[model samples]
Target: MSTPSGNGDQTRRDIQQTRAELGETVAALTAKTDVKTRARTKATTAVGGLRGRVTEAGQSAKTRATQLARTVSQKASQRVTSVRQKSQHTVGAIQGSAKASAQTAGKAESSVVTSARAMSTRIGSSVRTKPLPVLAVTGAAATLAVITYRRRRFR
Candidate 1:
């Protein structure tokens, strides 16, 4: 049978019923507290295991990184030392080459000076013998070269 109650009274009754159900549910949960505890314990153990694995992985990575860094540093140092030795040898070779070139240049200069003086003496003797003919020939050659250069330039 439907109760003849106002809407506000019906709402209060529904609220009271929900509160009673909630009380019973709380009692049931209280009784199963041990089960909840066990579930929580299992979850805690799983999380601890994951934490251990993560810590171990981090440590392993750190050790490997340190080893790789050391190896790279050692190799780089060795390469630098090798390059330094090679540069030293190259510098020594360049110095030796420069010294040899200087000596050769000095010898060539001395030879040129001696040859120039000897040629000057020979020219003086030749001028005494046939000065006029040599001067005329030189003038003719110079004029011919100048005329040829002008013709080529115009063309």
Candidate 2:
């Protein structure tokens, strides 16, 4: 009876040892799996953060480009408007100068006509009263005066 009881005691001790080793292995494997899961989650979050930053940078660049283009177009339109206004003013000035020149020409023509009538009347009176030699000399002097007056008037 004493020998059988010692064998039973040894067998029970070996079974208990095996169970303890199996429990330790399972705990270790569970801890490693938990650590790996945390590392993978952290990496995924970092990638998402980088993606968000890149998207924001792209949107900001597009907004700036649109604003710059609008500003350039507005400035160009203003410059074109300014040029158009200057051209219109120049055209108006030219028209005014032409009208004034036409008026001056009409006045000069009227003066020339009056001078021609006066010269004709004086020549007729001189021809009626003068002696033949005096009339010939008067006619030659009148002809030279008329020629000089016409040259000056036209100029």
Candidate 3:
């Protein structure tokens, strides 16, 4: 029932503080000694971080693939457009060439027809001017042709 001294109260407080500090140290040591729990915790954290990284990488790759596909499509479209333009130009050139060739052929055919008609007129004039010699030569040629035709037919 006697009142405690001031020094005794201070000592008691110090002892309680020491006991609290000891308890904290013991708890820290117990946590460190528990290897299985620490390892399990570390493994869970590593797995979570790795999963996040993998997911991020996958998303990045998907984005790149989409960009690549778009690039290829655009290039293909450009190439197609270029080919179409070139083909159109080539077709136009070919048509122009064909038209020029047709015109030249028409001119040549007209010249040939004119030459044939001129030769026919000259032959007619000659026959009319020399009737007796022409008849005699014609008679000789007809006789020779008949004789040759008979020989060929018999063979």
Best of the candidates, TM-score: 3
- Candidate 1 lDDT, 128-153, residue by residue in tens: 88555444445445555655675698
Q: How much does candidate 3 score in TM-score?
A: 0.56
- Which runs in model 3 stand beyond 4 Å of their true positions? 1-4, 101-155
Per-candidate TM-score against the hidden true structure:
0.45, 0.39, 0.56
Checking candidate 1 for backbone clashes, the offending pairs are: none
lDDT of 2: 0.66
Per residue, candidate 2 scores C-alpha lDDT tens digits across 93-128 of: 555555665577655455555554655565566546
| Prediction 3 global C-alpha lDDT | 0.68
C-alpha-based local distance difference test score of model 1? 0.67
On the 0 to 100 scale, the lDDT of residue 108 in model 3 is 49
Q: Which candidate number has the best lDDT?
A: 3
Cα RMSD for candidates in order: 30.8, 32.4, 33.3
Instruction: Please give the distance, in angstroms, between residue 45's alpha carbon in candidate 2 and its true position after superposition.
Output: 2.4
Error of 3 at 129 (Å): 71
Best-to-worst ranking by lDDT: 3, 1, 2
**Model 1: lDDT of residue 47:** 100
